[model samples]
Target: MPTIRKKGEGQYHVQIRKRGYPTQTKTFTKEVDAKRWATIIESEMERGVFVSRTEAEATLVKDVLQRFASEVLPTKRSEQSDKSRIKTLIEEFGNYRLASLNSTQIAKFRDQRLKVVGPQSVIHEINLLNRVLKTASMDWGIALPGGLPTEQVRKPIKPRGRDRRVAELEIAKILEATESLELRTIVTLAVETGMRRNEIASLVWDEIDLKNQTAHLPKTKTDVPRTVPLSRAAVKALNAFGVKEDGRVFALQAESMSQAFERACEPHRANIVGARFHDLRHEATSRLFEKGLNVMEVAAITGHKTLDMLKRYTHLRAEDLAKKIG
Candidate 1:
C-alpha cells in the first residue's frame, strides 16, 4: 500500500513500502504526480524489478567522488593519479545529483572540458567518471539512469606514443648539470634500468640485492612486483653511491626531480626543446635492444607488463640501427 499526505503549499509527499524492498519516499508538487510514481514503484516492487535509488538520488557527484577516494583509491597503486582525476570530476560536476545526470549534460561537460585541457587529459577525466559510475551501479546498489554518460560521448583520440630518445651528448650535459649527486644517480638509474621516475623515487635499500645484481620492486605502476636485473653500470652507480641501511634509495620526490631535471636541461633548451626526462627510459629500452636483447628479455628488465607497452619505449634511431646493419 502507498500512503500520500498533503504538505503545505500544494505539495504532496508520497511514501511507499513493500515487503522485501526498502522504503522509498519522494515529494512532488502535485498529488497526481505522487500517485503515479507510487503506482509505478509499487508495481516494480511486486514484479521484483525494483532497485533502490534512494542513495543514488540523494547522493551528489561530489559525495560519491569523496567516497571513492576514501574507500577505493587507497588500495590502488595509481591512487594519486586517480585522486587527481576524481578531484577534477568533482570540481566540474559536484552539485549534480547522481540520479539526475544524463548523457546530454555529461556530453556538454565534455565539450567544455575539451576547450580548456588537451584531449588526453579530458579523456583521463572521463575514464575516471565512468569507473565511478560503474562501481556505483555494480557495488553500491545505486540506480543511475542510462548508464555511464561517457559511453554516449565521442571520446578523444588516443595520443600517439612518444618516441623521444635522449642523445648521448645531451645525456652527458644533463649528468654534468644536475645539482645534486642523488639527482645524477637517479637519472643514471632511469637510463640504465629503464625505471619510471616514481619507481626510482620510491625504491628502498631492501629492494636492492647488489650481490645478485637485481632490484626487487614490490610495487610498480602496473600493480605488479618485478625484479629488475641491474646493469653493470646500474650496479656500479649503486656501489659508488653507497647503500642506505633501509630507506628509499634516493630521498627524491618525483615532481621535484622533474623540476630539477627541467632546470638542468634549460641550458640546452633549444637543442632538446621537446625532450622529457621520461625519454631516458625510451633511450634505455632502445639501448637494450641495440645490445641484442630479445623483446621478452628487454620486457623483463623494463617491467613493461606486455610487449606492446615495451614497444612504445623502444624507438631506436635510424642512424643507430644503420650502424648495426653495416
Candidate 2:
C-alpha cells in the first residue's frame, strides 16, 4: 500500500512500501494520479518487474553523458575517438530527460545524422548511447522506458570498403608537395610496409631493428604486437630518415600528419577526390598482392586478424592480372 499525504498547493506525495523492496516515493500534482501510480507500482513489485524511475526521470541526458565522459571514457583505449562521438551525442540530445528517451526519438536522430555523416559515424554514436543507457539501467538503477532504443532504430547500410590505390602520378604529386622530410618518410613507410599512419608515426627507435629488417610494434589497433618485416624500400627510407637508439622514430602527432597529407593531396584533388591518408594502406596491400604474396603472407604484414579483413585492403587490378594471364 502507498501512503498518500497532501503537501501544500494541491500537491500529493505518495510513498509505496513492500517486503524485500526499498520504499519508492514520488510527488504528484493530483491525488488521483498518486493513487493510480501507487497501484501500478505495487502490482509491478508483486510481479517482481518493478524498477525505480526516480533517477532517470529526474536526470537529463546531458548529465549522464557528462558523467560517462569523466568516469568511463578515460579508462577506454579509444578514449579520444570515444570522447569525440560522445560530445556529438551530447550536443544533440543533452536536454532530453533520460526517462523520455525512446526508440522513436533515437530513430529520428539516426535518420537526421545519416544526412550529414556516414553510416559508420552514426553507428558509433548510437552504440555509445546504448552503452550509456545500459550503464544507467544496470549500475545506477535508473529505469529506462524499455529495452535499449538502439535495438529498434534502423541503422544505415554499411559503406563499401574503399579501394582507392594511389596512382603513380598522384603519388608523385603528393611526394613532390610534401617538403617535410618527416612527413615524406612517414608516407614512404606507409606505402612500403602497409602500416597504419599512427603505427608509423608512433614508432620508437627501439621498435625498429634495421639489422634484422623488421619493426616490432608493441601495440597496434588490433591490440596485438606485430613485427612488420621491412621491405628493402622500407629499410632504405628508415636509414635515410636516420634513427635514435631509444626515442620516437618520428617527431610528429597523428592528427598533424593527417592534416599535412590532406594539404599535400589538395593539388591533385581533381584526380584523387576520395583519396585519404589511409588509402595508402590499401595501395600498399594491393602492391603486396601484385608482388605475388598470398593472403596469409599479406595478413602477416598488415596485422589483419582474419583473411576477410585482409581481403578488404587487397584490390588487385584486372589489367595487371590479365598481363600475368597472358
Candidate 3:
C-alpha cells in the first residue's frame, strides 16, 4: 500500500501511491513515524477526502506574513499600526509551519502578550494573525485541513474603557503651562469639537468653515469622512491664527503633539493626576451630553461609528444629571 525506505542516518522516507489520488511523500526521523504518516495519508485517500498538505506544510508563517505586508498592508487605513503587529507576530511564530500552527500555540501567545501589553493591544495582534491566516488560505491557495486555529482560541477579555475626564482647573493649568500657541489651539479644539489629536494636527485651513460653524474631516481613524460642528469658542480660536488657506492648522504632527502635551503636563502631574491629552475628547463628549444633545447629535459631532464607542468617551457628572432630573 506504501513504500518506506531508510534515506540516511536517522532519516526514513515514506511514499504513498493511491490509484485515484496523487502521490504523497514525507520524511520523518523515525521509521514508525514515517509509517504512521503514510497510513493516515492512505486512509484519507481511501475515503476520497484527501487534500494535499504539501504546500501548507512547506510554507512558514513568516513567509505568508511578509507577502501580506507587501500586498495587503498598503490598502489598509491602519497600515502603520498593522505593520507593528505583523512584526511582533513574525517574531513570535515566524519559524512555525502553517500546518503545525494550532489553537494551543495561539492561546499561549495571547497569555504571553497580556503580560507586557493590555488586553486591547493583544486583541489587535491576535486579530491581525487571524486575518493573515485567513488570507493565506483564501487568497494564497493554502489549504488548512483543521480550519483556522485562531478561530478555536479564546481572545483575552477586553478591559473596561477609560473614563478619565479632564477637569476645568487642570485644563486651565495645562493651557497656562504651554505657551505654544499651536499646542494651546490643539487642546482647545480637542475639548470644543471632540476631534482626535491626529485629526486636529492634520487639519488644513480649507477644511474649516468658520461662517458655517463646521470643519470637514476628509480622513479619520475609522476611514470615514465627518463634518464636525464648531462652537462659537472653536471659531474664535481658529480666527486667532488669521487666514492661511493652504497649510495645516497646527504646526505639530500627531506624535509631536502628544510629546508636547506630555511635557506640558509634567509640571502639573500632581494636580492633573492621570489626565492625558485624550481626556479632552472625553470631556467634550460628556459636555455634549450634558447640554441635552441626543445620541445621534453627539455621535455626528464626535465621528463615533457606534453608540458603544461614543459612550466610552462620555462620562457625565451625576450631580449634573440630578439637576436635570429635578
Candidate 4:
C-alpha cells in the first residue's frame, strides 16, 4: 500500500511499498516534490529495483573502518602509520554516525583539535574524516543524516610552507654535535637517504640488503616503499653504527632522534627560515640534480609519485641551470 498524508505546515509524507521489497518513505514540502518522488519510485519499482538508505545510515563507524582495515591497510606500505591514523579516527569519531556528521560540528571539532595538536595535524584529521564520509556516501550509497559542508568548518591557515635544507657547513656542525656513533648513523642516513626521521628510525634490519646495495624503506611519510641506493657515505655510516642483534635500527624513539637533530641545529634556528628535519629531503633532491642526475632518477630515489611533488623538492641552483643551457 502507498500512503500519502499531510505533515506539518507545507510538508507531505509519502510511503511507497510493494511485495518482496522494503518500504521507501520520504517527506516533501511541496506537492511537486511528492509527485516527483512518487513518479521515480513507481518507475524504479516497475523496473524491479531496490536500495536501502536507512539500513546504511544505521551502520556504525567501526563497521565503516572495515573498509580501511580490509581494503586500505594491507596495501599500505607503512602498517604502523595506518594503525596510528585509524586509532585516532576510532578514538575521536568512532561513536558518531557517518550520515549524521555536519560541517558545524566538524568546524568545532577542528578548532578544538587544533588546540591539542598543530593546525597541520587538525587539517589532516579533518581530511581523514572527510575520506570516511566520502566512502560511506559514494561507495555505500548512504544518505547523509546531517551532511557536512567541510569548507565552512576549516580553520584559517597558520602559515605553513617550509622548504628547509641543511647548509653544507651547518650540516658539519650537526654531525659534530651528535658524537654518539649511533647518532652519527642516524644523521648520516638521514642526509643521504633523505628519509624522514620517523621512517629512518622505523627501519628494521631485515629490510636492508647490503650485497644488493639497496635498503628497503618500507615505512615512509607517503606510506609507500622506497628503495634507497646505499651511497658509500650512507653505507660507511651504517656499518659504523654496527648491527643491533635485534631487528630494529635505532634504540631511541623517532621523536628522540628528531629532538637530537633539532638540538644540533639550535644555533641556526634564529634565522632557519622554516627549517625542519624533513627538509633534508628537499636538500637531498636538490643536491642530486646539482650533481647531474636527471629528474627520472631523482624520482626513483625519492619515491615521489608525481613530477609535481618532485618539483617541490627540486631546487636547482642558478649555476646548475646555466650549465644545462650553456
Per-residue lDDT of candidate 4, residues 1-326 (tens digit): 46778988998999988886678888888988897877877676777664545655577776776676667667665556556766777776678766555677777777777778887676666666666667767776765634544544756475444556678776776677665677778877877876767778788888887667678886677777788887888888877778654588888788787676676666554233345677777888888878778988888888888987788777667876887899
lDDT per residue for candidate 1 within 81-114, as digits (tens), equals 8888888888888999987787787788788988
Highest-scoring model, lDDT: 3
Candidate maximizing TM-score = 3
Quote each prediction's TM-score. 0.83, 0.82, 0.86, 0.70
lDDT of candidate 2 at residue 169, scale 0 to 100: 80
lDDT of each: 0.84, 0.86, 0.89, 0.72
**Tens-digit per-residue lDDT, 136-255, candidate 3:** 999989998778999999998889988988888888888888878787778888999999888888799888899999999998888899999999988888888565878777789888
Candidate 1 achieves a global lDDT of 0.84
Residue pairs with backbone overlap in model 2 = none
Higher lDDT: candidate 2 or 4? 2
- In order of listing, the candidates' clash counts read 0, 0, 0, 1
Q: Could you arrange the candidates by lDDT from highest to lowest?
A: 3, 2, 1, 4
Candidate achieving higher TM-score, 1 or 4: 1
Q: List the residue pairs that clash in candidate 1.
A: none
